[model samples]
Target chain A: PDPDAAAVQAAMARNGQLTKPPGALGRLEDLAIWMAGWQGTDRPHVDAPQVIVFAGNHGVTARGVSAFPAAVTEQMVLNFRAGGAAINQLARCFGARMDVHALSLELPTADFTIQPAMTEAELLEALQTGWDAVDPASDLLVTGEMGIGNTTSAAALAHAICGGVPADWVGRGTGVDDAGLALKAQVVAEGVALHAQARADGIEALRCLGGRELAAMAGAILRARHLRIPVLLDGFICTAAAASLDAAKPGALDHCLAAHVSAESGHAPLLAHLGKAPILSLGLRLGEGSGAALAIGVIKGAVACHSGMATFAEAGVSEG
Target chain B: PDPDAAAVQAAMARNGQLTKPPGALGRLEDLAIWMAGWQGTDRPHVDAPQVIVFAGNHGVTARGVSAFPAAVTEQMVLNFRAGGAAINQLARCFGARMDVHALSLELPTADFTIQPAMTEAELLEALQTGWDAVDPASDLLVTGEMGIGNTTSAAALAHAICGGVPADWVGRGTGVDDAGLALKAQVVAEGVALHAQARADGIEALRCLGGRELAAMAGAILRARHLRIPVLLDGFICTAAAASLDAAKPGALDHCLAAHVSAESGHAPLLAHLGKAPILSLGLRLGEGSGAALAIGVIKGAVACHSGMATFAEAGVSEG
Candidate 1:
């Protein structure tokens, strides 16, 4: 469903009357209005935001594509559950409710360099898990991932959907050295080439190249879109997850925000290709939705000011 | 006093042990270390951040240099005190203690195009007012201002200290039209020309070209520097105020962070000149320390992740 047009118009009208000069709030004004339309309220606010971290193990980890071993993905899920990860701290700091989902960690996805990463049934189940995980009461959503070799899968997804070579989409995921970077790029090239159907179908790309957690994030984002909940897309891997949706159907990400460009080099070109401008350029490379979670504070301030501030008339201040 | 170096090293060592990959947290890591050094704690947090807003009237408003009337300054000050302004909401949102001080509102600063904006006594008093307003107990500080036509004052100050021509420093402050922008550029050029001594002396620039509120911000920033309280420079005007301190002495803003570059065109060049990279480029042009206040969330998230997250040893997760 499209955002309510009347609420957006009303938000714009109210923003103009705010004490500050028109457009002085810059992208914040646009963000507030965007939220207003989605929430169907001229006064937009996000009191119950949700941060979900999906964890999956990748068979590509056996290829020396990642610095961390595959078991770390499951261990990090436990860390998240124990509230000891970076995402937990960030979510708590921003007053967000956080959840972690570990998907078939014992059964890693197939190595995409050799064949498809997931069967259609596996992809559908992962997407269903993501869709069912979203809490309907959430006014805002952020989907993040924890996977050992997911960046390889993400790079392959980008290479497939955006028609890029491996190097353009690959980056040093989780502090891999130069040789690992080169090897990951080569793996991405091979995986993307082997899955030619992915280039023609965004959903096909998910089955052929993306990991389970990445598929879950895409499903969660799609659920948010259907529910008219505003979404803040995290760094590179998460962006690629959402990009698959946009590729399958253009404007699928219209309800989502490219929260920040990560330290990953591929994120910038991917954002450009999707025509989304990230609000933050922080050098964050963490993928537990940490960057997007931190940005929750920014969005809160925007809505707080939008709803709480006095208008020119109410303040009895002269307007320009 | 400089930041505590020992604490900084301790924070860096702690950051390396966090569960996430090294440098994965990006500039958040640096911000945490910066806060740690200033607060003299390995676990840095901004529990009692202070936001001070100084309001004054600019005599240059008589020259049609602003879209807002001079009377709007006092009115906006009332709005701030009434907790009805954008800054009030933002400060509240970030859990910062908000204080507003009206500095000789009845006595507008002299128009710098004709003569120095303030006499030696007036500049000293404004500086003293700013210095005294800061609470020593607060760990973080952000100084903002409300004054009609102060952008003209700020642009003039930047021109004097940074050696830029008027056009290089002037911008559409408070939504001025093309003609108003041209007039502001002319005003800045004339002000810089009339007060040539300001070009050589940063303090002289404040006395000759800066408004009372701007000088107050400079003084407050200096106080934070002395107390080793970390500061977040707001938008163009606030950055200009802090630049005055840096001009008087190299590394004057060493304890400060350039929070964001504003919509004002001069801000980018000014930040570049100072060799400070802003964490945000949100196109926010609203004064009253709004931009920096919005950034408190980012800083808080950084420190929270730095201080609260468990190490790989504690979480029992494999390290990269």
Candidate 2:
């Protein structure tokens, strides 16, 4: 059975049964129902949606593509662990759990104790780490990343996968100006050219060119899909990891649903390539699963629509 | 004391203090916090949010200005009362109360079996009905309308209040084409000319040309302000009623919050006249408090930002 196909069809059917006009809730209606199908039930509910925020030190941060200093990556990860960031506040609002992991990829030692970057030989161990971290009963997994200038890594990964011009995929990272973006694009183009042979190595290509958290997220998604767990993906950065993972295994996206269509221009194109529909388009550019946490309610709403709505037959109302 | 001004300022201040970047949440940030200040508390929540739907028979509907028949207004109200309409489903989702009123000035009946429409003599009663219907302890009032050619009524009312040319305020209502809109503008212009003398009588101008709900909602807002209740307003039709009330009593809009910036071209000008910011900019042309219901979450989010977020001092984080 094509679980993804069956799941998607089930989602659409749930949306059709909602009390509002068909498609009245727009992208939100689609997302909630899609999540319902992925959970394989009409009464889809998210209890303690966990946000796994993985922070990696990207070699690309050496180049000045982002507004913040590269040191901010580990710093923000600590802030996340301490529950002092925007995403942490959002998680508290949604009553979701937050897990912070520092993946020591480029700089083997950060001030904080870091998880191993995990060499090719240790990939199995890393995968097991991911598996043990997630609850099998989780309704959803939301993976986010913290690495200064990670957008540059994301763009490079997108370039390697799509074979599209790197300049087209690049954008202002963390409120960079036009000139900064131009520099960012030039850096991505050079990085893609530099990493061309590595991308040819598949997952190894990802390890060499992608951020540590992104790769870990890829591993997490693979494990989630294997365990039949569903994932809610955030903006462009997370989408990049999902795309790279999908390239490794053709249907990896089968377990994934998009949370928001970001204002970042690259996000829409990347989501389009992945063939995923985003739930909200509020011009949100914040990372760290902010979109995903907010969207948990929408999925809940969809479940409510399917289960809570008294059908026309039940409400004793004539259907036109 | 300008209660409205104080409320507006408190809202702005509370929003600025929210956890996100100063203006990152955009219009939504403003809406939720504004509501908190209006409610005179930090933890602003909507319990029993009521949507007062006003239905009227418009002469413009007689001129074929709308796609649906004017008879649909009464039919939809009955549908609403029967809990078989789009608004019914939304009200159910939001846990809001729905009240439909038929204006005696435009409807076939004046008895109390259904809601009574008011004449000038019963203005105080109409105002009190709006005030009493809103629960004293409730957090918000959501307003919507259902007159087939209501856009024509809205445009004319808008023209009377703000003095925009009829063409500027006229637009497609329920999929009317360019030609249909042009005809609508001409009809509105004629109506405006015919009612020019009533301009001296602010409420009279509204009564002679406005929809039943428009007048009642005007009374609603005026009463809501005196009662210190907050009103969450819907699209163009409701906005026109709001503008009319604001023009009559300068502080009437103080207790009201615009729920959306509709695709209706007239809405922006009317909003500018009212000097209020709408919470959402979804291109919703439907005027059933649907946009308002969606925006409620945003308001809640803002309130959370104000009441739930720790100050820089409280969080003990460096904010330099």
Candidate 3:
């Protein structure tokens, strides 16, 4: 289903009537109009926003592709539950309902450098877990991931689906050094080389090269679209997951906004490939939906100005 | 007084100890540390952010330099007072204390195309009005403006002090058309040529070409620097006011950050001249400190992540 065109029209009319000059609020006015279409209201408010973080362990950690150990995934998930992580603070600050799902952190995915990252059944279950995680009543959705060495899997997935070389898709994830970056690129090449057929099918690529958390993000994004909930896709891993959906079905990401381009070198090019402009770009790379979670404030400000400002007539201010 | 070096060092050390990898927070980490230095604490928060909107009338409207009538200045000030403007909503959304001051709205400044915009006495009073309006206890300051034909005055000021052509300093302010834009550049050129002596002195340039509201903004920014309150400069007009301060004394704007690059054509080059990279580029052209007010949320998020997140040892998350 498409956005409500009538609501968009009403919002656009109201935006012009507001006290400032037409389009002076810039992208914020556009954001508010976008929210209006998705929420089916001329005056849209994101009263209920959901932030779901899925955690999965990656066997690719064995390749030493990341700076942190795989155990840190479970630890960070615990930190989230304890409300001690950056994501927790940001979500709380922006009034988001945050939930954490640990998808078999004890069961590491098969390393795509050697074999498929997940069996078909495992992939299906992970996607199902993501689909079920979204709250249909929530007006906005933000999906985050917690996994060590998942960036390597994301790089391989992008290489497979986006037709980029392994080097173009690889970057220093979680503060890897020069040697580690080189090794990660080599690993992405090997994964893409072995899973050649995956390049033609996004879902097959997800099964072959993406971890549970990445697949879960794809599922959550897809569900958000069905529920008419606007999605703010996070950095590299989350974007790659969303890219899988776009690759599987072009225009699947029309309801989504790129939250921010991360410090990861691949993120800029990836966002360009998707033709999505990011809301914020502060070089953030901490991928627990931190950037998007922070951007919740930007969205709220946009909506508030669009809805709350007085029209020229109401304010008795003359206009051209 | 300069920012506290000891506090900055302490904050940087604490940042490295946080659960995330070093520098993953990107420019936000820098913002947090900058906040720490200004607040003189290892854990900095903008608890009392003061948003001051100074409104005045510009005689330049006589030159058909603006889309709105001069009466709209007072009307918009009333709009600000009634909480019916975009800046009001943004400040409220970000939990800032917003204040509106109309600096002699009934007495429009002299048109700079014919003569100096203000006498030295009048400019000093306007500057004093701005300097006195800032609350010394406030931790952060954002100065906004509401004046008809003020962008023309700002363009003239930037031209005299920043060594730019009038065309380079003029834009379609308040939604003026191409003819109005040309007229505005001519107005700026005439003002700068007549007051060419102001080219060497920012204060002189401000007196010759800047409106009361712009002088007030300059005064407010200077007072903020003296009080060690970090300032978030708004779009073109506000940046021009800050540029006057920087022109009077090099490095005077070290305590300020460019809040956003506005849709006004002159803003980007003006910011480049000041050597300040804007935080947001949303094409926002609505003054009244709307862009900077919106950025209050970003500063809060940066502070929250820097101050509220648990350290690696506290969260029991492994660090390199």
Per-residue accuracy of model 3 over B29-146 as CA lDDT, tens digit each: 9999999998899999978999999999988898888988889999998899999999988998888999999999889999888888999899999999999999998989999999
Counting clashing residue pairs in each candidate, in order, gives: 0, 1, 0
TM-score of chain B of each: 0.99, 0.83, 0.99
Top DockQ prediction, candidate number: 1
- Tens-digit lDDT string for candidate 1 (A16-108): 999999899898899999999999999999899999999998988889999888889888999999999999999999999999999999999
Query: What is the DockQ score of candidate 2, to 2 decimals?
Result: 0.20
When summed lDDT is taken over every stretch of 10 residues in candidate 3 chain B, the lowest stretch is: B157-166
| Candidate 1 Cα lDDT to native | 0.92
Pairs of colliding residues, candidate 2: B104-B117
> Which segments of model 3 are wrong by more than 4 Å?
none
- Residues A141-249 of candidate 2 have per-residue lDDT tens digits of 8877777777777877787787778776887656678888888788777766766665654465465556667777777777777666678888888898888877776
TM-scores of all predicted structures: 0.99, 0.75, 0.99
Interface root mean square deviation per prediction: 0.8, 4.7, 0.8
Whichever of 1 and 2 has more DockQ, that candidate is 1
Residue-wise lDDT of candidate 3 within A1-320, one digit each (tens)?
Answer: 67999999999999999999888899999999999998899999977888999999998889889989889999999899999888998898788999999999999999898999999999999999999999988988999998999989999998998886889989888988999999999999998999998999999999999999999999999999898899998999999999999999999999999988899988998999999999998899999999999888899999999999999999999996
Candidate 3 — what's its lDDT?
0.92
Ranking by lDDT: 1, 3, 2
What does the i-RMS of model 2 come to?
4.7
Q: How close to the true structure is residue A289 of candidate 2, measured as C-alpha lDDT?
A: 72
